[model samples]
Target chain A: MREFALIDRLSQRLANRRADTRLGIGDDGALVAPSAGQELAITTDTLIAGRHFPVDTSAFDIGYKALAVNLSDLAAMGADPAWVTIALAAPELNAGWCDALLDGALAAIGDASVDIVGGDTTRGELSLTITAIGCLPAGAALRRSGARVGDLIAVTGTLGDAAYGLQCWPTRDNATRDQQFFIDRLARPQWRPGAALRGLVNAAIDISDGLAADLEHVLSASEVGARLDIDTLPTSESMMRSCDRETRLGLQWSGGDDYELCVTLNEAQLDRARAAIDCPLTVIGEIEAEIGLRAFDRHGVRWNSDKARGWDHFA
Target chain B: MREFALIDRLSQRLANRRADTRLGIGDDGALVAPSAGQELAITTDTLIAGRHFPVDTSAFDIGYKALAVNLSDLAAMGADPAWVTIALAAPELNAGWCDALLDGALAAIGDASVDIVGGDTTRGELSLTITAIGCLPAGAALRRSGARVGDLIAVTGTLGDAAYGLQCWPTRDNATRDQQFFIDRLARPQWRPGAALRGLVNAAIDISDGLAADLEHVLSASEVGARLDIDTLPTSESMMRSCDRETRLGLQWSGGDDYELCVTLNEAQLDRARAAIDCPLTVIGEIEAEIGLRAFDRHGVRWNSDKARGWDHFA
Candidate 1:
């Protein structure tokens, strides 16, 4: 397949003809109109072949994850995704591969409306980049520097399933229901619909680099500290059945790729926020006057912070 | 250098905060507010190590061109560039290389008034991707689809200089003034300042893949054809002095990477439009009812359109 053919296929699948998208696909650049008082939120991610994911992974999963990861950033900012630009590099183009990739990418944006506006396709080492553009009300973006003392630290959805899935993928068993659930979570992460809680949340960050590391980013940015209640971590039935309590806790704290939002707020209105987005959120900790992370078990004894080594791409 | 440290270096150079940019660099995504009555224009480009530029080319030039190429797209759409997101991948990060790269990129945006918003860094084969976002007045974007049958075909600045420079690069023979001029054009292309002609122009496109191929895109999109007076082609002093008439014409017709604007309009207000942008504009052809390119030399004899083979990535 030729590059233009691949681009043509991608453009056709990504076309949505939105009114605000003044020009899309075949133009030198995409033209979009933002309504007055709405601010544009732009995020970019580059997924490499071997470093970010296993080379044997399906194009479908790669495509889905590529856009999913980028959208996760917008979600952290409480922005509604509207458009995406992809820069794709590959050794060669295969028709079936391209089709599967688009199928997964199109399905990834199932409800949260977004149009693939403009992009670049070229020949190179296998790498896919996505820049997701979204919008929010001016001065209403959820930032990492907003957490204050006494705010409740919460997370949207269950954590650590993706990391568990990655560990189990080597075996490729899937004999138990737990394996499938874990793998699915890794391959296709569901983004939290917490954009509605923009004003309610004091600070937010998407969990890509383990819960501990990502939360640290918020704390450092806000110049605050966190006290995580280890026993309060939200876990799925599959997660609980698949591992011991200490192992589950380790994964919850250190396993990355959750793509869930770690949010902080002053009030304990998680029920309302969860209902607003139809997603489960658990209050796992609280912002403190301290300067660093302090994790405690049910007995209120602190867990060693040195044990949590979060995912770092370069490292 | 670590990814975060490299990002810090980049941020320090690219930090020229603007009012509309609510958040930049260190955030999950950049937050920007486009003024009312303006539409956002966005484009993305990826430059592979061996394909787009020589593997041995200076990192500074690579970084500058990476953003310059994307900005050219905005220039074609007649948009005012504002924000950029960059994704960089390299086998290894060298401190000197990073400094030079950012220096060149920051210098490239001189007086263009843009901010490096947010991006990613990863370890992989050498490649760079840039997504530039700009804005234009609503309903006033110059598009390739707006050309009329009688519109005059014009180009900005001189052509064939970059192609000449590229061909002359291997020898490293900058002993002559002409060779140095050509090589400089290849390394640092000046994007035409025709965005000011938005209201006055019917259609516009940036010449990256040579005039013949790029102009064909505009013609096909506009559902029109072009008739070119080959003798009227703009030529730099060095280009004319260095090459014979036939070789110079070939470079003019098929040489890519000029980064100049090829704009079309009907009324003969060339001087006014040229004065608006302070860029030299030369009329070379006319849009016609004909179905394809028709070129004429000084003798009025038609030059075979088949000879105008333009650059194709996949070809």
Candidate 2:
């Protein structure tokens, strides 16, 4: 089949001979042996061509972001991303384009220590569904329901840059260097949480649906609220240069596609947790006994959380 | 929010406290623990509305068949299925219809020892992608490339029943016993190979793309050929009552959606393999030194393997 042929092209460049992967790709399924005393983590996401990404977007960027988002889920759960399966359904396209797409995906996967183990390809609507599997020690996976009162809430890296990217994408020009950074951020987000920091976070979630909305998931699950310090929120220099204060701040608060990890942890673990990631880690909030998320400015005034637009109306 | 509400409704009824599944549906990802010294088997499939099933097919049938096809892949590999992840993308549909789909999928999943681990739900074109993870002892996972010359080729249960169902679906009636039986087979294909049959077959594959084409995959993978006895194919009473012998024979040979296991094994293993499967297991062919699949009539004359319609012309 042409689909299998394309997969073979991707497989030729793969060097995934991990000790745990007794079998990877090319069979009815892939065979893996999880480490003793460790738990396995799995996540799946579907990206539609018109709804999730621009139709004209390069296959390489699409491929990179698809895996990146799934990796973000693993990072949020404090798991080491190990394997992925992609089920791509598309209208008829040039084989060359498919090859480029797979090359881009494999390029991203190669560095993350993730293997393309299994997949299904068919002709239909253009959609990509990916399942990422990861591993962590038993009882050590960072969940969203473990945040307690007074826990320091922190985020790994700047936010809203990707949202800013999406906002300015149509007007992006080669001359707007700062805006280009936002677009690039949207296209290729890095997962800042590494294996070394798995057990340090009390609660965690990936910012796929904006910090305000995703944090609400943590609050609702943990039965606690958070007070975020708006001034202390991390913002990229590019985002500041590209937009006005209100637009920038609004994007920072309610914008989606950040792919950063928002976590709650003990204050004592802050130094060690920050050291584990190369990105700037900012302490944005603290959990409270109250049951709804709120944000406060440096002047000690509450900012309206309801004003920030929620990305996923579905959730 | 409605999607999460629907998921919660499904989750409340789930009693999955598997020691392997530390975390389930609600988290960013699920946490599972595979036993030490066992290999994990992973398979993924994607089914699109209109392409995989008739647009008017019931949500219940669609949901059941989606999981059934993936389970068939696991059965082919002789893997003990353990976990499943579904990424569902659909256009706007009624809440009641969505509930019916989930109920159907859950009903099928409830009987198997598999847990619904993680998934993504979103608004998009209608498609369902499922990834199933299974476990087997290290080096024990079945493969399609292990068949050798002189091995006996066998099949489980009946063939062409689902294909027959599709052919007769337009005329199906609730009161027509044979038609209802065929339709049910199409919707709820049972994976006949249980755990007891694992490691008993040399090489296997689910008969998805018709025996003429799927057999080529095994032959090409194993670097062997097959000579199938056309008379030996297992056909159901429903098929006999519904069609002429020639039509039944043609459907049995070239039709898809059987979900039956077609395998090759040493002649000595026949008794044990048949004993392991409660469904009828019949020797249908033999692996040979020649490099092509040839099906023979009971009179010992070769039937036309090439004239059989290729279900997947992509190959």
Candidate 3:
């Protein structure tokens, strides 16, 4: 059997009626027209085996993570998930594995309320590239360039849990309940934020490359600086007990893969946001007029060196 | 160096300005607002080393061909090229090689009048994926299902050139000027008729999977059938002289990588299309009421049991 034959078989399994999809598989591209009063937001991410994840990772997890990361981007933009197209490359055709991958991905899509529109599958080393399309109300997207000086910088939920979980992967010392929670957070993160912050947040970004680095992205794009209050940065008691203070703070501030939404809001809206969201909201910093970031200790003195580096892709 | 660092380095080279591009390289996703009154048509394709192309192929050619194939998809959809995003994976971070790839890709974008909006780069096995977004008039897209019974099936440019070129790759005995032309076509095919066929074509698709298979896709999607006149299928004089009659006909009918538009049109529009396009339009078949495809030789006998197959991704 050839590649086309494999695709034909796979496509048969994928054939189903979708209301919004004007056209599906077997064309040059999928065609879709957005509903009235909604604008489309599209994002693409690629994951390569043995680089993005371990080769031993299950196909189900790979599918779940690929869709999860893309959905995180949509959440950051304050857009409602809509559609996705996947371009998959694998060394060989394993029908059972492919079915499981699709099942996992479809499960994620069901949770996100997004549809799999169309995509291409080819033979190569295992790699997945997914482009997600979302929809937002007219003039309602929260962009990175909207932050202003004196605004309160905030983050959703706890940070560094995922990084700490990764560290635990090397040594399976503790099989405690808290340790299992952290491990699950690293493996399958859920970015299910409350809808109340949709129009309230001014500027937002997902914490993929750690707090320090991702915050830098928002500040730089907004043409402003920030001053993080070191003591106010949120972390769990389990993370604190597992690692030393310095390591805990470093991982919390610079460790990536948390997938939490880092947002900036006006000082006046802070109270309303705190009351609305189910997850803990911490005002870790404030937007500043300066050109770079600074972290201050509880005593109001600048803590640590200004050369804090987060997870760099090519580092 | 880490994967994110490599992305940062490559991203700097892709940073530039375009009026239509709402956002460029460094965000969760690149955002673009198409011109008013235009509909966006998006397509993505992935090329892997040792699969889509030979590993020894030039990086520049690989980059150029990657974008070209996506552009061919847009052309088949009767769309005006607008923007593209590339997700690249490689085993190593060679700055010079990456620069060369970008240079070739940018050149092709310039020629096609498309903008490089954003992309992601990571370290992995060599693979390149590109998602192309184009704009077309609000309701003028040429889709596969739009073909009607009695519609003439026409193709742009001669076929079998790329297949013959691949045959000559091992032995340079056929390395004449004509063979070189075919080789160039295999490496970098130019899409024909350009955006001129947008409003005129009833149904169209790019011929990347050879005429036999790709045409079958159109017929199947449209719930119609076709009777191809094998003698009417276009074949270059050089190809006919170099290969046997059966082989020449097989290449012309089933050769992949042509990138030419296979279109279906009403009889009334034939004269208008002939006047608009520079390439010769060969009417090789007509849409029938039944489902499936058939071919007839000069003797009016059906040409069944074709052994020539198109490019398959899984084989």
Candidate 4:
């Protein structure tokens, strides 16, 4: 299929939704009206080859992961996904690969209730940038600066699975069966935070960078410090079985690409939050008066180092 | 300066604009509330190095041209310029170059009363994509499908200056002082027909891929045919002096990137349109009953062609 034909076919598949989208695809740009009493939240993320993802990754995974990560941003803001515009750059027109990629992207968007409203296709080295727009009730959206001292720091789902999966990808023979599950989670992580927590979480952020680095972002934004307890960090059963305790804990603490939500709430609201979420909420820390992050091991020893850094685009 | 700092500087400079921008810069996305009874019109254009522009072109001109092309799209739809989003991909970050580029971009946006609301920056091969959003009254949007047979085919401003500029860029020795002026027009074409023709044009499109090709797009969309007079095509005085009559006319008829509005209007609206525009109006043709485009000379000699070919991405 040519670029125009491929876009037409994809547009047809997307038009069947008939949801909140005022205009579907086939135009210079798409038009959308926001739901009443809601503010639109928009974000753009670009995934580049050999930088954001490995070069050998499947086209399907690339497509799936591109939209998934942007959806994760919306989830962190406690917003309902609405529409997305993808600007794709690739070297040549590969019909089969394009179809597969679009399939993966549409499948992910379908699950999130987001429509592929508009996009641009061009020829260049492989790079995909997705701009997602979500809607949230007026004055009810979450922000990174809403956390207060003495708030309970909680994280949904598991961390480090994606990062560990990446580490094991280059040497499959060195990976155990349990590690394979970690790899899958890394490649196709789900980012649904459930609709119930819309009004509950105060400050929230998704763990695209490692837990330590992402937590630092919240700390810096909220102007509060945090002390994470190593014992309370959530690690998947597969992670625990495949790796030693220290390695698992270290990965849980510092590995990145985990699209899990790390949210902060007042101690008074913890009971309500605990009852709201279906996923495990690990209370690994507490916000402090000081403005930095620290980690305490099970032995009560603080792990003070400059080594537990996450992914840096410039670096 | 770093990317964030550069953005901060640029945002500060744009803070003085009085455009209908609800939110300006330094946010996840800029917010603009369309006026009551108005619909948002949008279009995106991507320019890649060695593809859309010469490699050694000045950064400032590149920036001016990038935003100008998108503004031309808004002009074609008979919309008032409102907001623009720029996505820039480059191999390296140079602060001086970035400042110069932003200067040129802001100059154009400022001129059109469009706000530089939000944008994305990434490191890659040099390419710039701009998504411009405008506003037209609920039922007054001029679309390509609204043209009717017997309507007069008109063009705003002259054509072929930009294409002529490209040819002269490689051979400075062949370019006269007057030719350089035409070259600059090609390098940084202005978008006309701002708020003046919001309700006058029956159907319109910007002449990016030359008049023959872009008019065909309008024809194909409206399912109509046109008979263009080759003798009536508009050209700059410099263009006429520098090139032969055939080449100058051919460039006016078929050259791309003029960024001028090509519109169809009834003969009844002709006098009002001529009075409304700041630039002169040239009637080049009339819509035909058949379903294809043809060109005729002043002597009524028909040029044989099955299709009006423009710039094709894949071709």
Candidate 5:
């Protein structure tokens, strides 16, 4: 009964009235009507205490990041976010804690028009599994397999701020403004909309496991390769001020938790895509006929891709 | 790298080459094409170790029940199973254990025509969260708000056997065939198809948190009451032989996890509904003008609902 009472209270805090959601919450399942000519894009992600984030991380940030990460996946597919189901498990039902967590989630979903449709609340070790549903025009899905040889590879926003933020977190109170920027980036990753880039990008993926590893997924799927210009990789002003060139370069390439979009497009579409997107877009690589990734510095010196590795949870 | 490798292996084991699933497994989000004139039904559930099931429960049964329970939700909504996204978290990635778990999930999904779409794998305390998507003809969903006065309330299959199974699980090897029957019900709750009952039933819900509790949800939603005939609830012969009368009645009313459909319909549709459904259907109650549930024996003696309380994760 306490679980039911808690869910009822939390459901009210998250509820939104939307035309597409015929039924929401308080049901066995939610009924959703998709647009006439759109296909549904579905994704699920899980965040666990002490694994995905610091053990002592605030519930507010955890809730915010959970939704942000799933929305990032939808953005990668060039789909418009519509609905989400949250399955939350916690050791106890603390009203104040749950309220703050949900408040942060609502903040992350601000004006995106996504509805919290259905969910299950259970008692267990702290974790959240969120399944986000979105819609895309029937043939407009930006699949990972569509990257072709000669396509220009681009990324939105700067990378490695989140990783740097993790390192400076313990002593965050004494940090400079530059360091605080990194910490904020770690806590609340902005959900960059990619739905407008459908016709401008050949393939797209979100940088959850770092650019080096995530780009490898697109390369493997498309059976192509890429050569990145190390000097062209984007870095934040804060990163430039706080770290040396080597550290910044490694973080830019291999540091994870940057929820930015990495896309491949033709040269002709570059200008139009930049104007269409909401964030800073930078080209750092081009697709190749060869089947693996390689990198080069400004002086044309080759850097082994193996030297900058991405995250592997089990590793 | 090992997490991705394990996911790749398990993905192959659970993959289905489906036409509706335009994109699956290896993407940020999956693209699914729902049939024209159908609304999507979405539901999510989480199963955690030591909380949802015994710590030593087989990975196979854990996988099977996780999917089964979600399917039960879809069934309650009168929807056809379509796709599922499984977010799995575990302490370690054991090859044999994962293979067996996937195999069990496959068995539960046997010939249902549902596809495994997209998911995330994380390291944490063992748990599985499954989000199930189903389809129903537009406006055909059997919601919980349509029951009315004089409507017949019916239940499918048997109840209470699962709760009995839980009690006998620790010494399952020494149990009789009848006791094993109850144990099997707990381990594997069959997925009953309810999509065919859309027009036949006015309202429906799955009996997960015991009929006594779940029925109250329907009464509360529809703004009506019910009079249940305790003598009429369907019970398995195994349940009858293993327990005394009062114990049998308690299990039937309050023991949870039966995964059976509880529905209401006009008396005129009873004969046709019984003929159409695949399983046994028995009328155990009728809607009343009052606003709460009451019970009666074969002799018409009244019984208070509070005596047979339903399971509450946090009471």
Candidate 6:
């Protein structure tokens, strides 16, 4: 397929024509009118085959994850997703592959009401860079710098499933139902909108570089510390049955690719935040006045985190 | 360099912290408030090492052009550039290489007052994807679909220099002064702000895919035709001296990578547009009510354009 033909197909199928879109695709630049009094939230992420994911990953999964990761960043900022621009570099063009990729990308935005405004496509090693734009009320963004001492640290949904899912990916075809669940989690990480928890949460971050490392970012940014109870970290029944206690704890703290939001909130707002967030909420830590992150078990034994290395693309 | 360290260095050097920026780098997303009564103009472009440029090209030029190409798109829409997000994937991290790349990128935005708000870094075949966001007054954007039958088609600056420059690129060190000029044009295509032309031009497009092909886009989008004069096509002094008439014409019509603006305006508005646009302007065609683009010489001899193939990424 030619570039124009591919672009036309994408424009027709994926263009989310919203009321605020003055001009969508087929222009030099997309023109969008943000709602008055709302600050635009922008984030970018790139996924490279063989680096960010297995090279054998399906086009559908690649496209889905590419957009999902950017939207997850928007969610962590307590912003409502408004638009996305994708820059795709593919080694070659295949009609069926393009169709599947577009389908998966559209599926990723299911019911989020965000638009695909504009993008660039060229021939290169298969990679996707997606920049997502969202909006939030002025002075209401859930920043990492807002994590105050004494705040209760909470996380949404079960953790470590995606990392466990990677182990089952290669044998996904012959996998058990529980393994299929883990594989699906690995391929398609879920992200909840943080807009509803804007006032309730003091700080928020998406868990992409494992729970411990990401919480460390919050601590550094907010100039505070955290004490995480490893036993309280949420885990699925499938995960519990699939691994030993030590393995489960290690995965929960250091396994990456879980797009769930890890938030810090005041204890008084716990009930309100639970009512506002439409997902499983578990308090696994607390923001402290100290200068570092510490983890402990249910038996009050200090768990050494010195050896827990998080995901690093350049390392 | 580790991922976080590289990120810290980049955040310090390239972040364009504007007053409207509520949050910049270091957060999940950057937050910026656009001025009221303005529409956001967004565009994205990607430059791959082997595809967009030579594999041996310096990181500096690649970085400069990556952002310049996106800014050119914003200029075509008569928008004032405001912010940008960069997603860089490199095979390896080198400090000097990274520093030069950042310097070149900053140099490209000289006096444009645009800011680097957020970005992503990863490991892959070297590639840079920049998404530029600009703003324009509501309903004042120059669009490709706005041409009229009587509009005078015009172009800014000389054409075909970049294509000619490519021929001399490999031996640029031994180039003559004139050859060096052309080489500079190829490496760094100049883009002017189109904000002043917002009220003057009926339609506009940047000449990236050669003049003939880009003009064809305007004709197709406006549902009109054009009569281009082959003899009236502009050429620089070096271009005129380096090639014969036919060679110059071919390069003018079929050669790509000249970031000049092609615009259509009324005869009455021509004087105002010329005054408003900072670069040299030349009229090469006229919009017709007929169905397709046609070219002719000064003697009214029709020039067949069927053989002029435009640049296509897939083809």
Q: Order of candidates by DockQ, top first?
A: 6, 5, 1, 2, 3, 4
**Candidate 1: misplaced stretches above 4 Å?**
A173-175, A298-301, B173-175, B299-306
The residue pairs found clashing in candidate 4 are: B162-B186, B208-B257, B210-B256
Write model 6 residue lDDT over A11-47, tens digit each, in one string: 8886555889888888899989987898999999999
Error of 5 at B116 (Å): 0.9
Better of 3 and 5 by lDDT: 5
Q: Write the per-residue lDDT of candidate 1 for residues A1-315, one digit (tens) a residue.
A: 876677777777766756788778987998899889999899999999987777877899988989889889999999999999888888877889888987788778878778989888788888898999998999999999999999999898898899898887776654467888898898888877657888788899999988888888899889998888899999999998999988898899888888999999877666667767667878998999999999999887787756566865566
- Candidate 5 lDDT over A106-167, as tens digits, reads 88888898998988888888898999999999989998998999999999999889989898
Better of 3 and 4 by lDDT: 3
Candidate 5 per-residue lDDT, tens place, B1-315, comes to 378898789777766657888888888999998877889999999988887777888989988998899999999999999999999898887889888787778788877889988788888899999999999999999999989899999999998899889988987879889978998899888878888798999999999889989999999999999999998989999988899988988888888999999999999999888987889999999999999899987777776777656766777
User: Which has the better DockQ: candidate 4, or candidate 5?
Assistant: 5
lDDT per model vs. reference? 0.85, 0.82, 0.77, 0.76, 0.89, 0.88
Off by over 4 Å in 6: A299-301, B15-17, B299-305
Under CAPRI classification, how is model 6 graded? high
- The superposed Cα distance between candidate 1 and the true structure at residue A188, in angstroms, equals 1.1
> In CAPRI terms, where does candidate 2 land?
medium
Q: What's model 5's overall lDDT?
A: 0.89
TM-score of chain A of each: 0.96, 0.94, 0.89, 0.94, 0.96, 0.98
* Every model's TM-score: 0.96, 0.96, 0.90, 0.89, 0.98, 0.98
The parts of candidate 3 lying over 4 Å away from their true place are A1-20, A35-39, A137-139, A170-175, A192-198, A237-241, A275-278, A297-307, B1-19, B35-38, B170-175, B193-195, B237-241, B299-302, B305-308
Q: For residue A32, what is the lDDT in candidate 2?
A: 84
Per-residue error at B18 for model 4, in Å? 6.8
| lDDT by residue for model 3 (B1-315), tens | 465555677677775555656566666666665555666677889988876666766778778778888888888888877778788888776777887788768766665567776677776778889988777776777788878999999999888887777776555445787777777777677766446787566889999878887888788779999888988888877777788878887887788888888999998999888778778888999999988788988988776646435667765
fnat, candidate 1?
Answer: 0.78
> Could you give candidate 2's per-residue lDDT for residues B1-315 as a string of tens digits?
367676676677566746677778888998888898888889999988877777778888888888888888887888888899988887764577877887778766656788887788888877899999988888887788989999999888898888888866886654388888777777777765545567787898888888877788889889998888898899898888888988988888988888888888898899989888878888898999999888988887787867565464245
Residue-level error in angstroms, candidate 5, position B250: 0.6
Clash count list over all predictions: 0, 2, 13, 3, 0, 0
Worst 10 residues of 1 chain B by lDDT: B305-314
